[model samples]
Target: MKDHHPHKSLDDVHESVPIHGGKSKFKRVISFFGPAYLISVGYMDPGNWATDLAGGSQFGYALLWVLLMSNVMALLLQSLCTRLGIVRGKDLAQCNREIYPKRMNFVLYVLAELAIAACDLAEVLGMAIGLNLLFGIDILWGVLISFADTFLLLYLQRLGMRKLELFIVGLISLIGMCFLAEMFFAQPELEEVVTGFVPSLPNSAALYIAIGIIGATVMPHNLYLHSALVQTRKIDRDEHGIRKALKYNFFDSAIALNIAFFVNAAILILAASVFHKNGMHNVAELQDAYHLLGTTLGTEWAPKLFAIALILAGQSSTITGTLAGQIVMEGYLQLRISPLLRRMLTRLLAIVPAVIVIIVFGDEKVGQMLIFSQVLLSMQLAFAVIPLIHFVSDKEKMGAFVIGAKIKFFSWLIAVVIAFLNFQLVYEEVTDWLSEIDNVGLQACIVAGALGLFVLLIMTIVYPWILKRKPSRSDIHISFDDLEFKQASSFRTILLALDFSKSDEKVISQVLQYNPAISRLILIHIVESASVKYTGGQSDDYETRKDLARVEQYAKFLKEKGYDVLFELGYNNRIKAIRTMCGKYSADLLIVGSHGHNGLKDIVFGETVNKLRHAVKIPVLIAQ
Candidate 1:
């Protein structure tokens, strides 16, 4: 038999820290709320406040029905987002890129970027408006001040997510207090407030505002944000904990939006009671109605309270919006754009237009832009929503956690209606623009623009459906058993391959627990795959010899620990050489680490461990 001392230095191979037994049930359950609560605040932005105020004021309590309905819908979708992260161990954007084709993935990326940009614009405007209301400063200067918020966000990241969570919770509480205070002071008649809660439509304009409330509250970017954030927690596979987490998510969402609902209702109630009855109708700007609070309520408390809440709402939502943009860009593009760069990109997009409008037309024009931006965001929601619903429902991707029948039906119904509503809104806006242009050439240009947008919209809706076709079995022919490995028995020799990646330590640690049963341990390093370009004329054989020396050093360390060991080096055709080593040594098992690449690379390359297992007879183990 070959001398076992050949593998003596194997001890130097990367080893993982042992996992202590699973976490307690209580700890796992409580950990779930951390992410859900942080991500939900994206819905409670100043833009949302404006919409709710607009909804309640113009139509009174009739639009409250939309808030109730949209929250229920958001709860269902957000729950799906959490489930996808927990079960797959990946965020929604990463999953979509893995399952979809390159061209389609590009389209999804552009649409998401546009939506986030639109949202960031809203935050910038809201912040500027809040500053204007609070300090009597120029809105342009307020927009410039908003740039410092990006650094503040980066600073918050250093304190860790927990600190950020507590901050948002406190801010949200302040918003609740401000609104509650305003509601008490305004003291609208109980009978009129009760009438507002009943479901009814005021007019076409009110209906559009109601749709905006739904769109702003249950945003598409937030679905991506929540899914990615949930992955930060280390949760066990305990089914009960997952269920508890889901329940907490629903409760967190309900409470956050309930605060939102009352604030929205209060805005409208204050507006309707103060402005509508006095014949000071059509309060386009928030400041327009601010003076009435002091005059009608016989106190200055209401205006100051409203301005403070608006500032809190703007700042709080901006933090989340910035974080969501980071998660989306990183997850989908796989590019690590620095936080400063991302912040600048979003801020510039928002501030330039905001500054131009304020400088050209003044602060009064900001509200109209706010309305346009919210509607633009509403139109973009389907882009994120459709991909999420489609990918989560696929069994091959999501496995046992695939969306249930009832959830699927309802999600698709909402997706269809949202797409239609966005389409109609886009159409009306374009035609209305064309109607304003009297010149024939400008009208012709508008017609072509509308046609192009319609085509783009149709393509976005149908693209996922087209990609859902199942691949033929022959296209991805490997069987599950081909990748499966059995635990080692005493008589066998095991070969372990190490790549020094993050996953490498995990595999090494798992293998060390085996009983000293294996007659031999081979620690092999193949230098053929290493890049030669940076090695400065070093021959392939030279590099292989050097790696072999390292392998021998590793084997020596293992031998001192009383385990039989050997080392080998190979320079060419890695898969072929690994197979040859297994056959020559009659190795009983092979272990490798994988990055868990899915889809095309998985199909074409057949995974290194899977390829070796098929080429030879030994069992193969893959550590992710």
Candidate 2:
């Protein structure tokens, strides 16, 4: 239950992905590839299919412009997320936790969770629908099957992050290929498809679907997910490395999201070419699209491929959504849970609503359900987006990495456009609901809820500018004359842990020179080999034997120098063993040699110096 890296985002995978130095430019670019692909799936999830299908079938290629605009917004926002993670080393949620009060963060966390749940709802419905269309499974059974699929996440995550990334990338590729083949069969006119980018809403209904498309494309959860995901790569914490990471990650996001854009556009275009062209404009349901594709294209494989792609999209997206859920929960509340438990909790939240809808309204309502879920996602988008813009734009925290005015202007513009669209959607939806309802009590409750959300939204937008954020230490400058300094004290007893490396001699020499009046020198080494790890000092492993011998020689050399020396070989658990030795010897100071390992090497060899310093009360000096 110990918080080893309390400030870490996605602690299990933070800097887990190795980035090799001195590699080819292509190789370097490749290392930063996976995080963005994970993000791209969220953009092309089942929610996207519903919105895109609805837009295309109802209005032909008119809303293709929406998709294009949304992609541009997504690319820019995700790039900002990459910058925030690389420059600040915190996810959006963690940044919010630091900047906002507990109550405010709780509200934001709730909103974020709602967005994740809405996204998961689309995944559940899409998976169930895919199962029903492909196999003869009932919707209820398919829902159950989808819930059971949460276990698959456990297996996938057990395989490590890189493998999980590969799996997601494979699923994304399958989805893209399926849509590509669908395009070839539908064969829409190039002239009309290009014109879809010209931006025109055919009717007010088109506005609703357009907003849904925007919500589906520029996801709220993805903003949180991308920032945390970028931290997976073990890039050096230096300006050059950060610049390279920023550049490579921008390329990564561009390529991955453009691929996502293609998949989404392909869906809309296919719906336009196959459904609208054939005068079946009411093809809103994914089920309808599936059946219509086979008949309209005169090939059974078309619909089969459609179902397969839907299943892949749902499956892949749910996996990443669960991951985002983990990031959000840990970052906001500092609450850590097992991956399986987190997946189950999120899946269950999605399932309860899905089950109720499936039972109460039946399968026919699911397509509407998917679109509604996406609209909800759009409503929640501003909460995540606005805070992200605020965090990355702050000069005090971001140092030299603060976003420039041009980027800031566009980022705010995106936020405002999204907020305005969401506000409009809310107004229209509320007005329609109030008109239809006869009960004043129900209307009052609805109005109150809307007012509350509006206030929260305004607060989200205004709070960052109004509230004074605590500045980082780097931003605080003081004159030397204004500070008080404590007098230096010499140590009587020092405990030094040795690894028998070449630096040990240098470390010992420095320790001797540090305090000539020191009364005792306790030289210790922990036998960290597998045999001694669990067996403590009982195992007679070759590595342990050599380590003990080396400690004795050092102790003998120190004793020859007319210094009282005590040497002991600890078993395992370097920090614990060193702490125990420090207490036993009553050491006033501890000296340890630094291997200068960082990033992946720290993960491999263990961050002994850093961990040991915190584990013991005595001062720890790293002999470089």
Candidate 3:
């Protein structure tokens, strides 16, 4: 009963392959090696390349210590993450829903997905840039081309977990080999390379790059990934077996992360040797780095190798990013979506802005975006880190494996330091921009950025403390259908809202099916006003005529069907309009066409049905 809520992690694969080996410590350790390797790929993703390139090109390996230090922190945090999974058979997402109230868990999930999205943008940009280097394709088209990998990811997963791991390891090897070959040819200064491992900040310029490196290296989603991945081996739950698995898992995480450090370090060292040493200090962009590698090293293969490594980095990271999205959605929100759909959803989120940026602005901003994306990842670290520390530190949750005083102190210290560094990065990045943007057309950007960061800082502090009370078992409901059916007959006055989607016609038809004897329907549509007044000065002819005609069709249909219909329209804040209409009409029930968003999006954005349920006191019905 100690593991009362012991969920079957990766329920599909766990039953397919159970571990049986009891002897040979070496062989036992190797089986636990795959998850950390997967997690380590995130450490060397395209986001890291952006930061490492900037650091090495500008400062010539002065900030390598930051990479080393960040990896150390990652080791500690990842170890704690796996302990949660191994001890409780629960990943970080599961632990979160179990620990926090429903409201707070949803918030945490949003922040986690936001962090994933930020990383995805970096991946998309890097892939586009890599394509530009390899084939001279435009970045916009390159971004669109990256979408084709969605099919590749779906196909790979169907082949099973072992094949996927082999595929990733092969890609990781390709990246390492390409970089290893480049680093050898570039021949970085041995003395400077050794000294780079020493901790030093050089100047404020170096600090910015150093902070970027730290942010890039320690990803929030990797924490979630590590916890879930470790459970794939299906280790024995007995005391001796648990202890053995923990020991080997630690070894796996350490070795894999150290190799990740090598990949990150090699990228920096290659940049420092080939670009910075040759007076090309501004090789910050992926395109610039690719071209300069050939120019500086006098080898045609250099640029191609750089581009290949980048493509591998972006592709590998995107695949893992999709996996992380699944773990997060399933673990936090209990929504089991197909990996393909989730991948497409996340890819689209990353791609839409990327496509827009390439179109409106030039593709050069991809480099800037890559750096900024890592900063956003830094901002979200506290949300994942604090919770992992809290849950692992809790004696009740972790039992015999709960963090000790020394571990807890250091873990909290890491969390506080990361959060503080993120705040500083934002402050400096924004204020530095604000100082440069004293002009007319962009003053608003600086002001908005400053305000945004201020709010972010406050959220960083207050977010963890929310939902402090225990989750109430009584709050659980088996089916929304049951609750809605229990009170179906009580409806007398119904408020129905429509957005004029294809679903709206069906919504109207369905409500007419309800066919109440004495009940009335208040049919409403909101034009969603932007400013204080309508754009046409409230006396427009053609546009308002079209809107009126649209509403009349619904009203005429309802009236002809022998039911009373009251038509109304409002502007802005749809939630407030709906609530006001409900109260003013004394409506017993409110019905709206659900756009049917049921994944991370529905949870994050508080979809129409959900927000309505929370906003109004009346029973809300989602029309089929």
Query: lDDT: which is higher, 2 or 3?
Result: 2
Which residue runs does candidate 1 get wrong by more than 4 Å?
Answer: 1-29, 238-241, 438-461, 464-624
Each model's C-alpha lDDT? 0.69, 0.86, 0.80
TM-scores across all candidates? 0.69, 0.75, 0.73
lDDT of 3 by residue, 212-287 (tens): 7777789999998888887888677788878877888899889888989999999889888878887888777777
Question: For candidate 3, what is the TM-score?
Answer: 0.73
Q: What lDDT score is found at residue 573 in candidate 3? A: 65
Count clashing pairs, candidate 3.
0
lDDT: worst 10-residue window of model 1 = 1-10
* TM-score of candidate 1 against the unseen true structure: 0.69
User: Which one is best on lDDT?
Assistant: 2
lDDT of 2 by residue, 1-53 (tens): 11112367777788999886664877777888999999999998888887788
Tens digits of per-residue lDDT for model 1, 340-383:
88888877888888888889998778887887777677766777
Model 2: per-residue Cα lDDT at residue 577: 88
Ranking by TM-score: 2, 3, 1
